[model samples]
Target: MINITLPDGSVKQVSKGSNALDLARQISEGLARNVLAAKVNGKVIDATLPLYEDAHLTLLTWNDPEGKSTMWHSSAHLMAEAIELLYPGVKFGIGPDIENGFYYDIDFCDYDISEKDFSKIEKKILELAKEKQTYQRKEVSKADALDYFSKKGDEYKLELIQDLEDGQITFYKSGQFTDLCRGPHIPNTGFIKAVKLTKVAGAYWRGDENRKQLTRIYGITFPKKKELTAYLEMLEEAKKRDHRVLGKELGLFTFSQKVGLGLPLWLPRGAVLREQLEQYLKRVQKEAGYEPVITPHIGNVNLYKTSGHYQKYGEESFKPIKTPVEGEEFFLKPMNCPHHCEIFNSSPHSYKELPIRYAEFGTVYRYEQSGELHGLTRVRGFTQDDAHIFCTPDQIKSEFNGVIDIVQQIFTAFNFNDVIIQISLRDPQHPEKYIGSDENWEKAENAIKEVAEERGLNAIVEYGEAAFYGPKMDFMVRDAIGRKWQLGTIQVDYNLPERFDLTYIGADNEKHRPVMIHRAPFGSMERFVAVLIEHCGGNFPLWLSPDQAIILPISEKYQNYAEKVLLLLKKHEIRTVIDDRSEKTGRKIRDAELKKIPYMLIVGEKEEASGSVSVRKHGEGDLGTFSIEDFAQKINSEVNKLINY
Candidate 1:
């Protein structure tokens, strides 16, 4: 008998050859029926894979992320089968499950596919899914795999197999379709009761732009039709909340092909919104013992080389700018931490002066592919509300907790109550992919996990998701429409200090390395503002709105009184504007509503003399009339409630 430890810490003695499905059966039949996959000693595998030794097993159902991934992966195979049936002689590149769904890249020679074919493909997928074909995994030798695909005249599979070792190659076969895969697939296709092909796009063979562009089909699947229907509804809502659509509607930001793709031009209104967000964080950072600093947009090439960024991301970075002087090269700064590291190294320090927090709204540039660019969310240039805390190793946890508090405060103020925390760690198998000593890596990972637990955060741990330098914690906020966006991050690094040879004198008068804590509550000004616009549906909170209130004149008669009201509101520091255009009151109101202005103050002939203004709230309709002072006081109170320094 071998020992199998369940997630709840229960140890069960089972036969040596018992598979994960057998273990689930021992637990409960209902659990067995729901089990889509299993995690064996942290590695996800088929539920039917037999275990012959002591192992830690976690049975995965639809509720677990791994289970969902397995289901989606199986759905991809099912999709491939459907696509093959619909289009014969189609060669596939890769089909993997993504965050929301799965996508398959296919080289359909002389064949055309578009959104119009989505229904037929989705129908085919569902029809195959009902067939209840079991996904059977089979290991194949490199030569055998080559023979299989070569006989089928698929050069794509041949190219893939060329890099894979003989013993490591595996193929998964379901129904009449078979494909090479390293999988933890669902038990059967029947689990995918509903399927939807979401989009069709063009992708390079291996994401290399120079390679042949293939047709990429994106899709999503669910175990229940009702769930699929709800997901479609959410997709519709997400479309309405799309930042690109809202940005144009509210005149927040814009992109110009002439200026360049993936670069945003912040209009006046958008600039005001960004400035308000920055000022809000600036105030919070001041209270939290942070000193603001500024850095240049370009840095010496040697700076990145010394930070090891050049070694890892040199090719991805924009080519260095050359100068008249030989060997003089500079680059648009890709990150802020390296410059901050130089700042810390500028002077000597002692343990007493530890935890030096350097904050900057630093703008940086990256060379993002045009296809990947999406409004402000994925941009070539953006400013990060970045900071680096240089502290003693003993102070890491405390500093991390402090950063968490600030993040929570900012999210709460922005009404992002549904926050999901994710702890990303390095992959153990690929130790060379990361820098820093094993001891420091352990220290950083544990510090993050402990702080997350102590703070009682709703956090999930994911491996192989860490920055190449260190482990980190990221906060994903769900907007009003239930779409999640990564907003905040705190990374613990021990590599940079060692790279820069930064030191601080301890109580023993011995030189010690200061641990570095890199954090950004708002990942970037552009992305944060974009998310904010969508989250609030452009009806920004009183404190953050670019134009909180608009003064409307019933006619040319009350224009003076409208100006008077606006002056008073501006005196009270409310962001108010006057719609003095010679248009009907209804048209003005409709325009203001479309702009998502929070409040509209209408002054007519009677109100101009009575010293009162008619008030209307956006989306909520009229809130009756109030004296100018009363309205100003009400707006001030609401703003103060949302933003308190």
Candidate 2:
């Protein structure tokens, strides 16, 4: 018998060669039925894979993210099988599960496919799923893999196999379709009760722009049909809340092809909104003992070379600008940390002045692919709410905990109550991907882990998700509609300080390198505003609203009253606007609602005579009447309540 440790810390002695499904059966039949996969010693694998020795096992159901990933991976195979059956001689490149769904790239020979064919493909997938075909996994030699695909005349599979080693190659076969995969798949196709092919687009093979463009089909699946129905409803709601659509409707931001792709033009209202966010963060940083700094838009290429960023990300940066002098070149700044490091080195520091924190709202540029750019979320030019802290190694945890406090306050103020904290560490198998010594990496990684433990954060550790320089504490916040967005990040870096040759006079009268902490509560102004737009559906908090209230005159007769009311609100420092258009009162109210303004102050003869206004709240109409002074006090009270943090 071998000992299997369950997640609840229960040890069960079972027969050797028993798998996770068997263990689940021992626990409860219902659990076994729900089990889609299992995590063995931190690696997700098939529930049917037999265990040869003692192992730690965690049964994964639909509730677990890995279980969902396994189901989606299996559904991809099912999708490929369905498409292959429907359209013969179609060669596939790759299909993998993404955050929301799965997509497959296919080189369809002599056949044109589009979104119109999605229904038929989905129908075929469902039909094949009902067959309950078990997914069979087999290890194949590299030569055998190449020969099989060669016989099938698929160059994409051959190219993929050339990079893979002999013993590491594996193929998963379900129904009449088989493909190369390193898989942790579901038990059977029956787990996919519902399937939806969302989109079809052109994708270059292996993301190489110079290569052949193949048809890529995107899809999603669920175990139950009702769940799919609910997902579709949520998708419809998402469309309505999409920032690109609402940004234009609310006059927040825009883009133009003449200027450039992936660059946003912030309008007047949008600038005010962004400025408010910046001011709020500035106040918070001031209270936390942080000093502001500024950096240029361009930096000498050697600056990045010294910081190791150019070595890692040179290809993604915009082309360097060459001066009249042959060797002198400057590149658009890809990161702000390198410049900040130089600033720290410019002045000598002593141990008494350790823990220096520098903050900047620095704008940086990157050359993102045209196809990948999406409104404000993925932009070429964006500003980061970046800050760097230089402290002794012993103070790492306290500084990290302090940053976490600030992050929590920001999230609380924004109503992002549900957040997923991720502790990202380096991948042990690929040490070459990171800089710095093992000792430094260990110290940095341990600091974050200890901080998470001390803070009692229910965080998940994700291997290989760390930045190239160090480990990261990432915040994945769920929006009001349940969509997850990575909003904040804090990284511990010992590498950049070493590369920059930064040091401080220690208490022992010796020079020592100071550890660097890189943090951004709002990852980028563009992306944060995009997420905020979608999260609140453009109805910003009273404190952050571009125009907190708009005075709408009921008719031409109340135009004087509207201006007087606006002036009074302005005196109170409330962001207010006047709507003196000749349009009807109802039309003005409707337009104001569309803009998502927080409050509508309706002024008429009665309100003018009484020196008051009829107020209506967005999404909750009829807030009753209030005197002008009383309304100003009310708005200030609400803003104070939100900005108290």
- Give the local distance difference test score of model 1: 0.91
Please list the residue runs of candidate 2 whose C-alpha ends up more than 4 Å from where it truly belongs after superposition.
1-67, 130-175, 178-191, 202-214, 308-316, 322-328, 429-439
True-structure RMSD for candidate 2: 4.2
- Taking the tens digit of each residue's C-alpha lDDT, what string does model 1 give over 132-192? 9998999999999999999888899899999998799999999999999999898888889
How much lDDT does each candidate structure score?
0.91, 0.92
Report the alpha-carbon TM-score of model 1 versus the true structure: 0.82
Q: Write the residue-wise lDDT of candidate 2 on 499-579 in tens digits.
A: 999999998999999999999999999999999999998889999999999999989999988898998999999999988
Reference-based TM-score of each model: 0.82, 0.85
Clashes of 2: 0
The residue pairs in collision within model 2 are: none
What's the lDDT of the predicted structure labeled candidate 2? 0.92
Best by TM-score: 2
